[model samples]
Target: MLRIITEPTEAKTELERISGRTQGGETLQQEAAVREILQAVKRVGDEALLDYTAKFDGQVLKAEQLRVSGSELDAAYHQVSREFVDAITLACRQIKAFHRQRMPKSWVQFGQDEIVLGKRYNAVDRAGLYVPGGRAAYPSTVLMNAIPAQVAQVPRIVMVTPPGEDGKVNPAVLVAAQEAGVSEIYRVGGAQAVAALAYGTKTLPKVDVITGPGNIYVTLAKKMVYGVVGIDSLAGPSEVLIIADQQAKAVHVAADLLAQAEHDPMAAAILLTTDETLAKQVKQEVEQQLRNHPRRLLTEKAIAHYGLIVVVDSLSRAAELSNLFAPEHLELEIAEPWDLLEQIRHAGAIFLGNSTPEAVGDYLAGPNHTLPTSGAARYASALGVETFMKHSSLIQYSPTALQKVSNAIETLAKAEGLHSHSESVRLRREMDNG
Candidate 1:
């Protein structure tokens, strides 16, 4: 079902279209709907959350039942197998270890003139983690979002996920949350859940930052409430852009592409290679491998609409097209991956060589898998410890230091026609001089 295009111009067009897949053609309507949900939640609080949960999720819940019970979290361990618990524990340790390496420290710089300047970093008081529960319970998402907050030492990490038709949260999600140091779990989801985290209800405490990925409504809701609270990124569907060569195995490359396509019908998988033969083989392999796949219907739709293959003149050209695409996940399947890695300028996560696949990063590879999608890699980055923390500029200017720069500051402030700004500095200088 994958289409192969040799012409460079057509490849560029297809790549652009695929990279912008989350534009959501009906924007005004969707934005208005999300805005209404946010406003309703903001106005009426938990009542609105209950109403939307019942309407959208088809599961009616009361105020007291909004929070997942402590017994439920304990029973989650009993429901999952020992293997599941062990695997989740292993992933939790790996993710925590990875983020620990990225922890940033507060640093202060001293100058000869005694002008103290530094940056102080502190974790937000509370953080909200949203885990999607539509197609499947994404325990991986819980690990990815919660571990970063834990590494940042966020005081309180609260998780919100949609309950199923049975009015119960997924056992796997609860187990993963607990493993990631999050004890507070709420069973509300969709745009309304975003509202609760942003504005806070009587039962749910407001969070300083919200992280995780969801559907269109959840994405737009995050966008709407961005000013009220910080968010990881306006995450789009999963995507992968791979650059392969003649030596790259067709089966392996095809499997990696399908790995991304299986995420959603809008997910994109693109392949660029100098070898026309390899491109065609990968194309054929993708179709062959999709035969009777569990997610065939959705994967086929993704391939038919967003999948693409480009036969370039050289590996350099392939890298050029890849940088233009700015994919969320980039895999270099060339003979010398590091050699071509020099040409890479934009990508959220990079998988090197033929031995490494994007799947490793998705699981226990020790990197946050919640990466920027839909060409957002050009400006955004993967969710990490920085997402749940903020920094303030620490400044302390001694009287002598202020005197040294007072004239410059006063001149600049007066030139900008703000006397009050300069007067404050002028008074301090005059006090020390007098």
Candidate 2:
């Protein structure tokens, strides 16, 4: 059953416990295992990928079969329905449009004495996208990860996903990848796939950045390979924190919470409300809805362990709690949502008004759904075109500009006891003077 906390101290303690719910001691052991996998792939490349795929995924694959053929890409469209294509196409358009606005522009500004200063933004040569495969086929994840790289104009975008026992990638996932302009895909996943992308196998080229969510192993692999290549944030399980008032419908609130809980057994669904009566109603509604749920076993596990409800005295207190958690998804299902939004300081994504569920953001809402989790919203942001591109500082100084600052540069360089650093500036000034 979902627990409700009335006391502020208990609520704080419970929220902290949930935020740090990730495995503690087991993580060290897992990291050691992941390190072995990474080193194996780094050493032998494609051979290691094939060996690991067969061992972990229970599907045997040959080196030639690692990369998905062009014929398979064509066949994927036929495998999925037209409705899915149309829907994915629309999502592609929406996501592309949204990220296009987020593309960082290269700019230069002239300053006094003809000093040039700005930044130059450019896309990475190649980008690797990891799409998790197991519980469900995530076409949306393909769009969310791929479209941003596409908008950033990443050249040679490649995808990696685990194949089914039949050694076939999910049709909808392939279709979404193609729709989002990623056709170079491989039928591989897990830490080995991450290793291949990072270390560069003979079949899979090394990528500049890897983006997508996966299980603990994949997350650890990304963490390990971060210095070798750029990556999106270390994504944790999905979570939603809903602050609803009496005006919000109990059924709607319950459905929204369940939507998050259904993602995984570790997913969290929390609600903070000013109305105790409404809180009770929502709890009952959640149980009533779970009775006939298809994923009841997993969803119930999530709700029973990570789910929570807190009846606060005011909406301000609710906002305070929500900020403290820094949830991946935050919904304001209250009368004056905009008014309350001002009080919110942290959250990966915020859904305003009663109608805007996290599902909309998960699907065709245009914003990238690849958001920070596990309190990372305190310092991080959602994945976007910025993830696939990098900026270089642009600096150029005229002879006049160099002369003006040469003495100060020499003084600072001498203070640091670096003769060559001081000489470089001194020579430029002397040449101009001579």
Candidate 3:
């Protein structure tokens, strides 16, 4: 059951406990396992990927079976309904339009002294996207990760997901990948898959950047392989903080909390409200709702450990607590949601009013749902077109432009005690004079 804490001190303590969910002795052991898998994949290549897939996923496959065949992608269309096709198509359109608006354009600025400087943005050569498969298939994840890379015009987008017991990728995920313009896919997953992308496997080529969410093993592998390649962010378990007022419906708030809790056993669902009566009602509603929930076991586990409700004095206090948590998803379930939005400072994504549920953003609200979690919203942002691309500083200086700045450059270099730096500038200036 969700506890209702009225004391500010107790509320803060609960917050600390939830925020530190993924830490401790358990995570240390998990990291060791992830490290071993990563090292084996690095050393053995395709042999390691197949070996681990057999052990973990209970599927045995050869090198050729690692890559999903084109026929499978084509057949996937027939498996899904026409409505699904249309829905995925609509999601792709919305996601593409949203990201296109944020596309970074390369530009060069020329100055009066023949000095040129600007930024040139270009997509990475190859990007690997990891989409979790098993208990749930996330076609939404496919669009979220691949659409941004598509907008960035990445040359190749490679996808990896765990195959089912039948040794086949989910049809919906395959269709979503095709819709998002990601043609290359491999039926490999877990830390070994991340290792294959970071380093190169005989079957799968190395990728420049990897973006997607996975289990603890996948997260650990990404953390370990940071400098080896680029990663979007070290994603953690999902979380949500709802700031509700008198107008907010108890059932709706309860549902939102459950939605987050159902994601993982460690997922956090918190509610901060001014109405003590409403808090009690929502807690009861959560209990009633979970009675028939399909994911009741894990969801109940999450709520029992990480769920919280704080009865604050005002909506401002709720927002303050929400900012402190820096939740991945923040919902303003208030009558004056727009007004309350100004008070919010740190949140990965904000859903305004009682109607705008976080699930909308999760499925197809056009905004990428792959957000910074575990308080990462305090510093980072949601994934977008920028994740797959890099920028280089474009610089050019004419001889006269060099002449004007040479003395300043030389003086600065001399101050830093770098003779060669000054000599290079002195030589350039001498050539101009000569």
Candidate 4:
């Protein structure tokens, strides 16, 4: 059952204390393991990748067979039901539309004196997307990570995922990749796959950027390879914060909270409301809902560890407490959601009204589901086309324009005692005079 707190001071302290516990210590042994895997793959290339595939995944694959074939993708489309195909197609359209609207475009501005300054946006050469596989297969992740890169016009999009014991990639994942325009696929995963993408293997070329969610080893590998290749934000465990009021349904609030809790044992599910009765009702509903969930054990662990229900003095107080938590997903279950939107200063994604659930944003909603986790909502944003593109500022100054700023530049250079910097400007002035 979720814990309930009434006092404001107690609630704040409890939240902080629980959050600290959730951010637990790592094993130095785990770091050493990941480092060894990364270095081996970096040194031996495809040979090391094949060995790790057999050792970790229990499947041995040839270098040529690393990339999934077109026939396999075709078979995947046939294997899934028509309903699923239609759903995936619909999601693809929505995701593409949302990212297309936000696609960055190159721009140039010119002045009367022939001086031009602007920005040019270019997509990365290639991107590597890591999709988690095993008991659960998330085709949605493939679509979310690959579609934005496609929309950004990335020339090559490569996907890496662990193969099953049978040495076959998930058909649903493959189909989603094909639909989302992924040109390459690799049957490798974990820190070794991350290393291959960061520092090219013989079979897998290095990518300009890497994006997706994975286990702690994958997250740590991305952190270690920051300088070699760009990466999406270092995502932590999933989290959801729901702010409800007297008008909110207890069942709806509870269901949303459990949805996040089922993700992982470290995930957080929090509820803040002005009505004590509603908090009590939702707490009961959560227990009732947990009994029916298939992942009840995992959800129960998450709830017992990180979940909370706080009954605040007012809705304004609830929002204030929420901003401090900076949860990854925020749901406004109050009467006037838009009115309270201004009060929400920190959250990776916000779902408005009782009908708008966090699950909608996770799969079918147009917004990118790859979000900052833990308390990263304080600064980071959801993954989008911007994550796959680089921006370069353009500056052009004619002789007259250079002449206008030359004295200012020289004066600043002189103040710093850099005579050579001033001399460069003086040389230009003399050349123009001649």
After superposition on all C-alphas, the RMSD of every candidate to the true structure, in Å, is 1.0, 1.0, 1.3, 1.4
Better of 2 and 4 by lDDT: 2
lDDT of 4 by residue, 28-145 (tens): 8978888998899889999999998889889878999887877787788877888887888999999999999999889999996799999999999999999988658889999999
Best by lDDT: 2
Evaluation by TM-score, superior candidate among 1 and 3: 1
Least accurate 10 contiguous residues by lDDT in model 2? 20-29
lDDT of 3: 0.93
- TM-score, one value per model: 0.98, 0.98, 0.97, 0.97
User: Which residue pairs come into collision in candidate 2?
Assistant: none
Q: Find the 10 residues in a row with the least total lDDT in model 1.
A: 19-28
Could you tell me the TM-score of candidate 3? 0.97
lDDT of 1 by residue, 1-434 (tens): 78999998999999999987777644788889999999999999999999999999998889999999999999999999999989989999898999999999999999867888999999999999999998988999999999999999999999999999899999989998998888899999999999999999999999999999999999889988999999999888899999998999999999999999999999999999888899889998998999979999999999999999999999999989999999999999988999999999999999999989998899888899999888889898999999999999999898899999999999999999999999999999999999
Please report how far candidate 2 places residue 1 from its true position, in Å: 0.4
Lowest-sum lDDT 10-residue window in model 4: 17-26
The candidate, 3 or 4, that scores higher on lDDT is 3
Query: Candidate 3 regions off by >4 Å?
Result: 24-26
lDDT of 3 by residue, 60-175 (tens): 99999999999999999999999999999998999899999989999999997899999999999999999998669999999999999989999888999999989999999999
The reply for model 2, stretches above 4 Å from the true place, is 23-26
